[model samples]
Target: MPTPDLMTAELTLTGRITTASNATFLGSIGEVEVVYKPIAGESPLWDFPHGTLARREVAAYMVSQVCGWDIVPRTWLRDGPFGEGMVQLWQEQDPVQTAVNLIATNQVPEKGWKQVLEGQDEDGQMVALVHEDSPALRRMAVFDMVVNNADRKGNHILAMTDGHRHGVDHGLTFHSDHKLRTVLWGWLGDPLTAEERDGIDRVTEGLNGGLGRNLADLLSVEEIESIATRCARLRLEGRFPAPSGEMPAVPWPLF
Candidate 1:
């Protein structure tokens, strides 16, 4: 998306992203519903250690675009009512009452927690949280690991009404080293499926050609190498790579 000027005359604040660690405003950049990061928000969180979250978000968007996966928010660098930072078009999700809800709810059954992205019920009715993990979802997990996504909580997985899973929030990615933290742990020791392996191969081959060139513009050579290394390790090991550092395997406050 083309970036708008800092002094845009038509932007309007419609909502606030209170879920994020820092303050963010939801506004329209032209006709898109975008979450804007203004300078007026609170200072960065000391524990997270992102000097500029907006920059990382934009970089992650670029990576997603090159990877041929529309898992990221439609991001762009622009100035909004808040200030200059990354802006993303908001995604809409279904509001069904389900078995595994990301957000807290009291009405859901205790045995099977109602999730935000439920699947069909026993009676063929649409339920909350979908059942059965998908190849696309697994692919997204590998991509998240490659990008060093620091935040991959359940709520971040936007389950669209059409059965598509969209991952969001890339502000904490590409830390120049192994810093992956996520919740998609379905395929811990399982072998990569054909499609999953094919995707990895595609990325590996792409890195040798146009993909590397494109990533180099936004990420360091070492960062890109780490991505390749991780991909190779997963392919060779036929399992999810284990963490070497002392950091927590999952991000804090999983929900």
Candidate 2:
């Protein structure tokens, strides 16, 4: 569908996503299904220390576009039935496909996956947090760093039928701090592939052009400048960074 239609079209609320931390709705603009999150319904947890969560979600989408990774689904701010909010094209993920999983430690596949952390479950069974070792997820990890995503929970990654991964719930992003909480730390200290470095280079160049201007509407000057700084540092380091000791490395509820 066209952009104007999504923006001005009448939004009908079909259902509510009760599992979301903030007020999230499953709705549609005519025949096109979409997710609408009105700013008024946002939880206070995300409003603090930064801009509105709705705008931050859009900011993440813009950065994802720069990476050309399709990490985030198409998202934008639009007027809805309740009020102004963020509207994103809803994706029907493959029910059987799972990019991230928590498996018994001893059962973890030695190949085709990487183990991130291990601990005991409530029942005292040892388990490990693991993710598929694939190019698509690698690109997602790189994209997460650029956006400073603070809440990359397992459910945020949508495993698609074509093996593509779409990341959602970016309300806790671009905080202008070292808050990179996520479950994608399996590649810590690994060398950045040539393709990953090239993606960062494209973002750096974009910062000086349209990308920078576009972010200004959703993020503060400090937050926008931080993106450039992050890109430069990643380019210089040429490796996936380990978490800073000052903050939590991974989000709670691994999957």
Candidate 3:
């Protein structure tokens, strides 16, 4: 169970995420929109330990910070009705604006799967995927691969109206084994830009300093090693593309 602190105030529920695998509540503490998840009393799918949920949530925020993108939600540990649990800041986005919907609308040219998340067209349909050729997107691909994220579905990406792309649903991250599955497969075999290489180097360097110590508390040694190995491989290959492996590129259900 999480130790209660004074700053951890009770949250008031305003909505519910019925489609999620876990019981998630959309609520607010003061003026902040947040989502709450109580500890499992009966069945737990991921079977997380008492404090692992909060730790993993924090880990996601740390990774996002290191990636130079405020793409992840702010997460913290808090006392819940059931037990210790995790809470995340809820982002206000268009209910219909998702990577999947944006891509499937076909408002953009179908060069490949890369036409996803570009933007809406003049006729209010989705345009081509803009991040397909960006250095930032390439770095994100490497980050996802290192984390072994198995559920990088289109819906997981939140495309803000202000041109910011945020990714959510990171509960399945940090798997000790390789299990990466994502939809950003358009960059396979493309050479990494200079900026992309520098970002990989930055990530590798970060792992040797404070960032490494912070992750050490939440992730296992093997997981940390996986992060290092992925960075090294990307640096050596000098390319941003789909990795050659027997694993599937997409996860089931798309979310």
What would the per-residue lDDT of candidate 1 be over residues 1-255, giving only the tens digit for each residue?
566553454668888878777778878756667677753564666444544567667767766666666778677666665567667778887777211243323344544221333345446665443222565577678778767887887677777777667787777777766678776655566677776666677777878987787667656677778778877877888766655587776666666
Candidate 2 structure, TM-score to reference:
0.96
Give candidate 2 regions above 4 Å deviation. Answer: 1-4
lDDT of each: 0.66, 0.90, 0.66
lDDT value, candidate 1, whole model: 0.66
| Candidate 3 segments exceeding 4 Å error | 1-7, 39-54, 95-98, 101-139, 243-246
Off by over 4 Å in 1: 1-10, 39-50, 97-132, 242-244
Best by lDDT: 2
Write one digit per residue (lDDT tens) for candidate 3, span 1-255.
443332466667788788877667787776777777765622344533443555666676777777665667677667665566667877777665444433434444454236423445568765444234444455567667656677787677776767566777777677666667877766777887776676667768889997799999887787788888887877787776564567676665554
Q: Which of the numbered candidates is closest to the native, going by highest TM-score?
A: 2
Q: What is the C-alpha RMSD of each candidate to the true structure, in Å?
A: 6.8, 1.7, 6.0
Model 1 vs. true fold: TM: 0.75
In candidate 3, the residue pairs with backbone N, CA or C atoms under 3 Å apart (3 or more residues apart, or in different chains) clash, namely 115-129, 118-128, 118-129, 118-130, 119-127, 188-241, 188-242
- Candidate 1 has its poorest 10 consecutive residues by lDDT at 97-106
What's the CA error at residue 187 for candidate 2, in Å?
A: 0.7
